[model samples]
Target chain A: MAASNEFRTCSVTGLKVHLPAEALIKANAVVAVVFLAVGGLFGLLVALTRWQAVHILPAEWFYLLLTAHGADVLLFWVIFFEVALLYFASAILLNCRLATPWLAWVAFALMLAGAAIANVAVLQGESSVMFTSYVPMKAAPHFYVGLIVFAVGTLTAVGIFFGTLVIAREERTYQGSIPLVTFGALTAAIIAVFTLASGAIILIPTFLWSVGLITTIDPVMYKVIWWGMGHSSQQINVAAHVAVWYAIAAVVLGAKPISEKVSRTAFLMYILFLQLASAHHLLAEPGISSEWKVFNTSYALYLAVLGSMIHGMSVPGAIEAAQRKLGFNAGIFGWLRKAPWGNPAFSGMFISLVLFGFLGGISGVVLGTEQINLMMHNTLYVPGHFHATVVAGTTLAFMAFTYLAVPLVFRREIVLPTLAKWQPYLFGLGVAGISLFMMGAGTLGVARRHWDITFSDAPLTFEYPPAAILMMGLNGMSAVLAAIGGLAYVLVVVGSILFGKRLDAPDAERPRFIPRLPTTVAAYGSAGTLHVPGTIVLVTVFFMSFVLYYFVNWKYLSEIWPMR
Target chain B: MAITSPEKRVWWNEPLHRPEVIWITIAFLWGLLMFGMMVYWHVAGRQNLSNEAYKVFPEKFAEKVEDMVAKYKVREEGATKIPVVRPPPGSDVYVLSRLWEWWPILELEKGATYRLHLSSMDWQHGFSLQPVNINIQVHPGYDLVLSITPDKAGEYTIVCNEFCGIGHHQMIGKIHVVDKK
Candidate 1:
């Protein structure tokens, strides 16, 4: 048991932070960043090789590094960061001690060891089976074993999060439905459980097959079960990042949700229907019935997508309502214009929200459509779509939240304030380019994971449109820019923790971590009829764009060769 | 605030604003429209993916491809030694995807329809037809059958988009659609 004195009152938020949970958050976050750096470098190499004009790596290295890049970034960096967020939402926000501090440390150690083992297997150069690791193409046994260990570790961390929630409730830490942020984290944790179980069911047999205990894993079955884990993991990201969006709004602007019932109901939709989206990956695969595909891919009438659309409106609506209450009510966009653009936390979160809805959300729905998937399955467009969602959306949101966490949780001031101000825009712009250009190239029918898009040296020949090559070149340039932005973020974050001014001592003269807002605000319904005409206008624009893009894809499908 | 517990104990009973009600209704209507389009396309659209698939052993699938090649081989494609098989209109055409190559080049009439049978001999592969932009997943032990009609006359390339192995990029096939006499 931790000592009662282990709690520290945050000078900024006035919340009691459990010291053990804080340390665990710090450790997990640091490891997550390290993997991000490693994975980002591998991704740069992949982009350069695909550029064709500057094809740097040989064929073998290209496939191997692509595999490494997917695993490290998609699995290691993202999951580790999510674990840290679980602690921050539960133990830290609820103002209670973490359940089983020793067990939390064990989880951390297991994750580190597992990541190291998996990376070693990949680097050893035989197990270049991409992230999907589709069957009949065998990889080293350690690859599966490493991933299983990693999943176990993540599962344990999720268990701790649930246990801590119980602790908070039993200790009567606070009142009234455990805060909206904690509820959102609870949504992520539930999805994580389903995802890990799916991973175990498929991977264990694959592992046994690798070691000669089992034989002949069916390719169709592997794909069906594997996507249950793969796609659900991204859903976990959606829930977590949406929570971050709400958290940033609250911390930066002291914004309360317009209606708790509405927002929470949207999250409930995700829990019920989001996992059915695993069918999105299997839409074009053989041996799957159209009835099954239509039912699962549409999520029993696109209810999960409806959930996202709700968040898309409410997140900004909350911000607009808060800004208006602060007397920024000149026009429709006055709330937006008067927003704190200079603050990295606010800027990053806002950028994440917009890019996610426009690029990721739109492209994902198009690709998931059963008939339209024929034009996109296994194309570079698939990666382009996901990069927008995971990188521009979830990752940027996480990075934004870090700026606030450094000061509040880590007890350190930001080291390079000027660089922090510009990092999100630079990163956001570069990633947007990557996603757009890759999708452009893919629209011209360029294959993904191909070492040579030109089909140079093949017995047969095929020529892509000149525009496709141009898109790859532009994508390579964007990757270089994103790499610089990524480097700026790492330096600022790592340098701050090590050398930035500490805020440990109870000095009244200390600088504020977040901008000061009025302490006493009007209660939810009492705040004189919340008017958010600005948010409504923005959502309308979004709706129009979505309608246009959706029809354009159907037009593209019509131009393809007649098939059934 | 989202970071703190709601001041009201029974927050679920709170009334939604006018804008939210309007937006949710619009979004749900849009969702229903998108769903309807997918179902509508199957009935009326020319371009649609086939859900007709059958499970078979790799050996049996290979034998079928060989038999088709033996029956329909016209000539060896220049320098490559792969047979360009011209199956008759409305007939079953088999193309095999192996380790690093898609075997047996195919030639079809521009206005003729044929049943195309695709399956892999080893790992899973993606059958990506360029220019026309039709793509489908091909897996071993599963024969994916598609009824394809070539509406335009030209040469098209089948690029293996899935990552089969180190030689995945090298796996390319061809289809030559001749004009109807």
Candidate 2:
């Protein structure tokens, strides 16, 4: 199974490297992409069904597609890509051998098994808990079991990745500090481990209960505990996005942050503080003390967001410094004018970060607040907010990273380079459109997880005004854009796998061109390695402001420090 | 320890004072804008709701209910509480019905713009208006308030949106919108 002569072994943490870890990551990413498309398809279908009140599929089939969409895109596709990223960050970037090749494969196998089981269960019409799996509404026992086993498998994968990271650090894998990309991924894995642990608590019990092992059930308690599992999973996804940002910054733009210590510290903060951010979801739920939600949101989530914001500034800071070094002196904005926007890698990095930081980031903060919770809770705005972050921010970042991973990891040349360039625009526009529609519909009080509004007795009518119908139509159009963009991704990836030029030459023979921004100024230093003390202090002061706000606003605690 | 030294720094490092401030300010401004928008939406939503109770249904249905209630009122020895007058097609009415729990309940009507104040004494209940698909969350301590006007006339089915244990799905209510003669 080990193809010895084909790939080069890393000197950092010596283990015989047969398959390029990049290829494994790419192959897995392809799988994730396929699942993402399926999820997107189901999302569009659900939207259509809700809008028109047409039963496209029977209840069983509808639920199956819904379940599959949640598992595949939200769960399977996202986690698989994160795993691929873990391997890249730990092994490939650090020039280290994996801790155990067999363990890596085992992780992959278990993930596949879990995905297959979940998919089959959904197809057979057994499990449909609407992704969150709130208690009392039980799915088949196998469904819960499958989810548990799947989570365990993914956690094991996290363990293996962590093992590689630790060994590389101890063994002096690289000459200097760990690369920023790897650091981001390291944080993501740390967050994932904790998040998955929450899943273990709820799924196991839910599984046991489903099999009639536990007769009595309290829905309220179950809801409280389940969110510990449920909400943290989203935190892991956000962490993955942070990692992708650094990866794109390095791999695509060949730009390194100005300060390694500052960047890594920000990532470390994300690792430590990300879990508490789950309180944002529990803001409006009854039984949870308002004080708890308030503390969680402001203290934990706000800190994590602060970490994200630090990185947000750092990403562009690195790019700007890098551009300066390259002698692009038009102005601060001149570097942007001069930078290589045409390159798929550069564009992806820039667009994903911009969207994640602004649109997604703002919505996240508002949702984290107490007063805003009354309006946005469980409404269409719920999906509106997530699609901005998960789909637009994290997923888009992964897609951009794929442009690099496909070639390096998969050993396949990109088929249509130009079309690849067009994807971010289309996907971004689609997400924006969908989010607006959902936000507007939320204003009109639309709920999620219902087959149709007609199913409810709210006396809602089909005769929507021009603005509402326009919003719905806009959402549909955005779905169309998303489909096209997703198709473009598949075509480039799959086409390269089947027909593109395969590099049979040695590692040295491959072209090594990490594209740089067009305009380069030589101001402070290489953005990759500058010491920016002032920025760090500023961020600290900014974070402390939130802490100060929390102290004064105890009633405001539910928004941040949620207990439920 | 050696790698951590400042001497090992790469080329692109610079202070982010300018960008950081600019971005944070932009975010703050956007936050204000959203808050403004949210306030507008809340007020607009409230304005759209009606505070009036049961408006007499269309011309046809109002006449039938009036006739039926009047006949019952005259036959009874003392049914003084019964309302028998032919209300204008636009007039409002309020009444009570026992839901799945056999508790006294009051519901709002469609098209009859009325402020329906609903509450359950015994258990948690869901007061959902059919055809409109608006669900007013109901609980023991707090009174649920909804100002609604049903645009369409029909038999609207109301089911509980909340999980209130067994027979939850069977919890149903009706709103009769009488047509004007």
lDDT of 2 by residue, A109-129 (tens): 788888878777776775665
Candidate maximizing DockQ = 1
lDDT string for model 1 (A445-465, tens) is 999999998988888878899
The candidate that achieves the highest lDDT relative to the unseen native structure: 1
- lDDT of model 2 at residue A47? 62
Q: Give me the TM-scores of chain B across the candidates.
A: 0.97, 0.53
Give the poorly placed runs of model 1, Cα more than 4 Å off.
Answer: A508-513, A524-528
Indicate the worst ten consecutive residues by lDDT in candidate 1 chain B: B12-21
RMSD (Cα, Å) of candidate 2? 9.7
lDDT of 1 at A459: 88
Misplaced by over 4 Å in model 2 are A1-23, A53-60, A454-466, A506-564, B1-181
CA lDDT, candidate 1, residue A289: 86
